[model samples]
Target: MRIIRTPASIYLFSISVIGLLFFTFLIKIPQHSDWIVMFALSGSILLLNYYTILIPPKGNSLSMDSSIYLASIFLFGLHSTLLVLLIYSVIFAIIQRKIAWWKHLFNFSVYSLMIICSYYAFILIDGFTGPISVKNIIPYLLSICTYFSLNLLLVGVYFVLEATENIINFFKEILKETTATYISTLVLSLVLVILMKPNHLFGLSLFTVIAFLLSLAFKQHFNLFKEISEKANKDFLTGLNNHGYFKEILEKEVTAAKENEQPLCVVIMDIDDFKKYNDLYGHIQGDHLLQEFGSLLKASSDAANYIVARYGGEEFSIIMPNTDRKTAYSFMNELRKKVNDTYYKGVEGLPYGCLSFSSGIAECEKETYSVSELLNKADQAMYAAKNQGKNLVQLYNGHSEYSVQRSLSLEKELEEAEFQLKIFLSKDVYTYRHSKRVYQYAVDFSRMLNLSVDERKTLILGALVHDIGKIEIPRDILNKKGSLDPHEWEFMKKHVTYGKDIISTNKKLEDLIPLVELHHERYDGNGYPYGLAGKSIPKLARILCVIDSFDAMTTERPYQKTKTFQEAIAELRHCSGKQFDPQFIEPFIAMIKEFETSGDEQHKEVAASIVN
Candidate 1:
């Protein structure tokens, strides 16, 4: 036999076993008096079951079958309740042939279990045997409590196992919808059970009519609740989730990412010159444009399983899960190009000459583990995109450095940095590798320190050639794996001055000279060449000191033992006030923490086991 032993199947089998065990307790079949009462109650349950109002993608539906079960139990006990529901469910299953066989079995078993648990609870609580009396309130309360508790537990377990979701959070989410329904079911059950004890036929008939009316009321109430929820979550104009709901989902996604060690990306977008387009077209057409863009975003996002929302007027966000930053950048930019090419009448009249937008992207693994931090980075990237030019997609690269207004010229400058590092490779291969490592560390740390776009550009480029002057020293001395003598050490110390002089020759690259010269300066004023100390050290240079030493500790060197990332961070913390600037330690720690868990190719094998 082909056996399916998945979580769903196992759960169904377990519950079915319990239900079958409950059936064994149905030995005491009721007499004529029970049948007379059960006949009307059975009909009521069957009719109510057929008229259930369903919730989407689930079996959470509104039905008055609980009152029938309660009334039957109060009248003739567990055996009668089981007998009534068994016949009704079988017919219900056959009538609704669309339901799978296992589902039908599961449904029947759930009801059987509920009745079993509730009946025993009622009896155990000293419930009266004969008539429904005020003194039997304890049993009624306990029974109602057991029924809902069992229902929640059985379904909750199935969902938790089937979906692999958090147990506590799943309960909280379901409670929002199911809490009131359970309360109403218990109250209605109590009323019907009491009335039926006096006259079975009349009470059952009255309850049936009352249940039909209640169903109508519940259907209307549920409809209204859903409508209200829609309005609250969605924007009035664009129909996208509003900013409030966006934050809600962002927080949830952050939690999920942290729990699963998965990556999440946030794409923040703003329509370029939208106000001008709106001004030229008027608010009526402007609203239409917003609607059109929202529709475009919704359609584009829906198929990708992204949560697209209107962050505010003219601004929007797309939250993507299990996506890397590189993939997210491509996706957002492709959409940006599509929007630019797609024509809106008045959009062409704006400066960009189309429906263009600026977008910023940030991923969870990029020093932005929290929702607020991710939003801030993504938002900054979006504005950086605007500053560079509209119709651009910018990934938050620690600092806003990549948003170079003069990117064509910036490209030329990058070639120079690469050229300097390349030339040094011939003289000392280790300096080449060391510079590269320092540059990469600065990239992550620059973002953590929130350096401005210009400063980040300078730091990244400077770190690349900070050791270029070491090329002038003898190759034998550079490659020596022992401590440097006095003459060799003095000669090596002159590299900073040599690098500064080399960088000063090019006006475009001159901003990096301070970083090249002052990176070795100490807070306590005992650094090389010049005894520059404290605030006297350039800010960029001070920032570079922490990162440079971090890279040195991480990578193998001729003199010092290469330290783990943790050891290096400790070294930085221990020397904070004396050697390194105290202000940069914490942010550097944050950046290193990001690198430890990051999936970035650079993070996999740092010269630096890392920190606590």
Candidate 2:
């Protein structure tokens, strides 16, 4: 016969034993006596047994034994039966190690022998000591205490063994199959026993058998549910929470935040131009990139409070609770940088020589809006990033009066400027194309250097209008066929300050002024404008300097033919740390290579010309 080593089996067995003893006591009440005390005692015993079994007490078995003894003293009388029971129980426990058969036999023999011994001892003691009634009462009370104590000891041992087995099984399978099954079986058997004839021995036997079966069923069902839940929540590709489960958790967190008055921030991110990347590199490589990006997010964020989820295809979101905007921004910035730094094999010419993404962040404020509104705001911010340019971060403060007015004013101005700028660039088609190309290069190079999205956006916008200063110079001078004289060169350099002045008055475009003014500043403090060098130059200006210069050199102008991509990169390499920030040069070169091979040659060529 197979020996049951499972916790469910032990728990069921112990419960059955306790139930049987209590049932026997209930049935043995004399017909004439009030059944109320016995009924109350039975109820108390059942409750105590349930408590012990359900939440077994901590520490040694002795405490459980004492409790059992106390309960027994109220029921059975003191006699030799108690001693006999205790001795048999100890002996049976020792010998019933291997087989269930022997253990059951020991259990039966111990209880039966103790009962018989108590009856005989009570008779003998009564005859020797005094009147039967008084003498018998003391012996009967003693026997009752001993019987309960021994029963409690047996039950406690069984409970401990079952609990240990269940814990072991839980570790082994992770799914609580045995536990669920046991619970279901126990509940069903208990209900049936309560409804059945209490005096019938068959009812008692049937209850024990049914309870054991119920326990096994409960464990199996619990394991099944656990397996299903794991499959439902886990992402197959990256082993992270899937989008559906992530949303579920986010909703819960949102409700919790509302109740507790805590702030919550959500960040949504997507790989910029991922479709182009996938088209260039195959789906397998694309999948690999997604997996890598997910892993990077997981590693960078705090696992305790942050929920990182695969929001969708090539998109991910992090839900942070109890975090303010500034901290949320910093956390996202770090995550972005870490992702940009990740290396991939065979892929080059993209930002970081592998992949890059754009992000939008929104924080929940007290009384601002609902969770849905926060999510919508984050989505809008993300789209704004895509609109401004990719590979950036956009934060949504959400529906401020000042911002709404500012946005409306900027929208009108941008539309007008876009029209005029288009006309101006078309008049000299090369100028418009060149500016656009340089903007791309600047954006890519800045990302490669791990610059913040705000900085990258500034660099790209600066690059687009970097030569806007040239608009003021005569067209003949701007596209001059021969090298400029010192006087003409002086006139050309004025475009930097001119462009800066043009954007300085516009509040929306004010941030772009520093880029325009300082893009020409050299690393050695030798360039134009303020001649700021080294750390004095804004890092954004340093990135713009290399990108613009490379675009100017590689693209064709009236005075010069286009240089090869390699030639442009080599020129930038030689000037590292002197004309450009030394740190940015390698990444810049890597970005150029990535773009060139990835069929973004037109953009690269246009950038080269603008730089020159």
- State the C-alpha lDDT per candidate: 0.80, 0.61
Q: Count backbone clashes in candidate 2.
A: 41
Q: Per-residue lDDT of 1-612 in model 2, one digit per residue for the tens?
A: 989668646555564565446434433333443344334333332333233222111111111222222223223333322432344344545555566764554455445434443344444544232212344456545544444444444544564565443434334332232234333333332243242334323433454344345435544555676677868887888767898988788888876676566778888888877877788888998888778778878876656468888888888888998887788878777766766677765457564475567778887754332455567667767776766666677787534333344445544554444454465554566666777877667656666666544445556666777666666777777778978888988998998888877776665676566677778889998998777668656666677788788877877887777889898888888888889889888877877677667877556365456436
Prediction-by-prediction clash tally = 6, 41
- Candidate 1, poorest ten consecutive residues by summed lDDT: 603-612
lDDT tens readout by residue for model 1, 1-612: 999799877878988877767776663566655665666677788888767654432337867888678767776787777878876777787788998887887888888888888989989978855566888888888998898888889999998888777788789878877877777777777788777767878877888887777667767777777888889999999999999999999998877886677889999999888888778879899899999999999998997899999999899999999889988988897788778787877776988677888999988852232476578668778988888877899888744644455333544688777776787656776787788788878877777776767667778888888887786778878888889999999988989988878877886776677788878989899997688778657778888898888888887888888899899989999999899889989888987887677746674443241211
Looking at model 1, the pairs that clash are 398-447, 554-607, 554-608, 565-608, 565-610, 566-610
Highest TM-score scorer: 1
Task: Please report how far candidate 1 places residue 146 from its true position, in Å.
Answer: 3.0
lDDT of 1: 0.80
